[model samples]
Target: MSAILEVENLRVAYPSRQGPVEVVRGVSFALGRERLGIVGESGSGKSQTGRAILGLTAAGGRVTADRLHFDGIDLRGASPRIWRQLRGRRMSMVMQDPKFSLNPVMTIGRQIVEAGRRGGVSRRDAKARALEMLEAVQIRDPGRVFDAYPHELSGGMGQRAMIAMMLVGRPDLLIADEPTSALDVTVQLEVLGILDDLVRDRGMGLVFISHDLRLVSTFCDRVLVMYAGRVVEEIAAADLDRATHPYTRGLLNCLPRIDAEARPLPTLERDADWAR
Candidate 1:
């Protein structure tokens, strides 16, 4: 079967006095109804690659690809109007920070309901569906959650609410950019479980972007190890223990282990060739 989303030779760049700062250089990948994790250190361009496909590049950043398709639709040269219509309804992104994503003045319920409304759901039915989604994300006291403002919720609650809102449209492809980064460890696992359930139940494709190599190895089905602005390795998540790329091996070596030995975890080694 063809991929639900596919990107080929994608490159994203920002103009700088030092010339163009290329953030994503010739990166490519495909996704099906499975969890695909993109992992790398800070400034590795993992997040930039995800946002480029979703038409959410930062200011002054330009996105280009030889071919970018979503659900069989060509997205390489799609206009902003077309992108706006495609985003949120056919595909959605869950940002890292809900505090910035959610409107400060709007009630949680209102924002979630509006998400459904944009997808052609009626006002009343959208509210009902919003409540149901909130429940699905393990948000207790749905009534209070619905009525409260964004500022009234805790970080975990807010993140769950954001997930609920993003999935309300039943988007075919979901790009989750460190969706659990702000939450506690326990909450992080809880949120991961929720996302797993969504993929299983709805057959949705997921692109999970994060710097947490250990977490990604455990949670994702496949992993893409990135360095600088390119993918250095692609391996099965379960096989991350035996990954071959120097960068991948370095990451694993740097992780703290339960059984072993060193007072301080060994630092990862990266060579200039790792960026090629």
Candidate 2:
């Protein structure tokens, strides 16, 4: 597969009372039509990197990169008109929570149809695609969900709806941020499976950002471990257990195993030098 997105020496900064605080520093990666996992703790800039790719950073924030390309388009130089054309059409994002992302007044079907319509589909065709996507995400009753409001759905249902909305546009790249964090273990796996299948069937590139190292290791093809706003390690998911970075090893050691004897879990030791 060819590269769909390429980012190099990316940095994001926000002005603070003290000064400009940098959240993401010198991050670089290339993504193809495959699942790429970004694992990091809270405040590690994982989400910021995803947002920067879609030009969704805060109003006062600044994003600078030596190279930021998405499917041969220069994201850094893209105009608002260009961004509007590309955002929902070629690239879409599934945010962390549907409760916050979805409009309360909009029906589930309306929101999904709107997503498709933004990509230039006719309203009638958009509605049909919305129903198809709802079923595609494993929702049992697509009609019931189509008419329901956001608050009427359960967490898992809401998430499935969110996925349906994002995929309704048939985007080539999907950035899913903590997509399964709020679900139960069973629901999480189900959602992940849905995403995996969709990516495989559509041949879309996925950037899966999450704090759960174990989940990412099992679900993703490759892993990028972040600490203090920078990528500290990059390794294949299958070789996650053999990670050489101290931060990656620390995170792996922190996960409690089902077969392990009863013992206290090790605490993650922080090193100031790792941030430099």
Tens digit per residue, CA lDDT, model 1, 116-151: 887567999999989998988778799999999999
**Candidate number achieving the greatest lDDT relative to the actual structure:** 2
Which digits, one per residue and each the tens of the lDDT, describe model 2 over residues 88-150? 888999999888989999999999998899855799999999999898777889999999999
Deviation in Å, model 2, residue 44 alpha carbon: 0.4
* lDDT of candidate 1 at residue 10, scale 0 to 100: 96
Clashing pairs for predicted structure model 2, backbone only: none
Mark the 10 consecutive residues where model 1 has the least summed lDDT: 261-270
Candidate 2, residue 98: how far the Cα is off, in Å:
1.3
* Model 2: ten consecutive residues of lowest lDDT: 256-265
Candidate 1 wrongly placed segments (more than 4 Å) = none
TM-score of each: 0.94, 0.95
TM-score of 1: 0.94
Per-prediction RMSD in angstroms? 1.6, 1.4
How much lDDT does candidate 2 score? 0.91
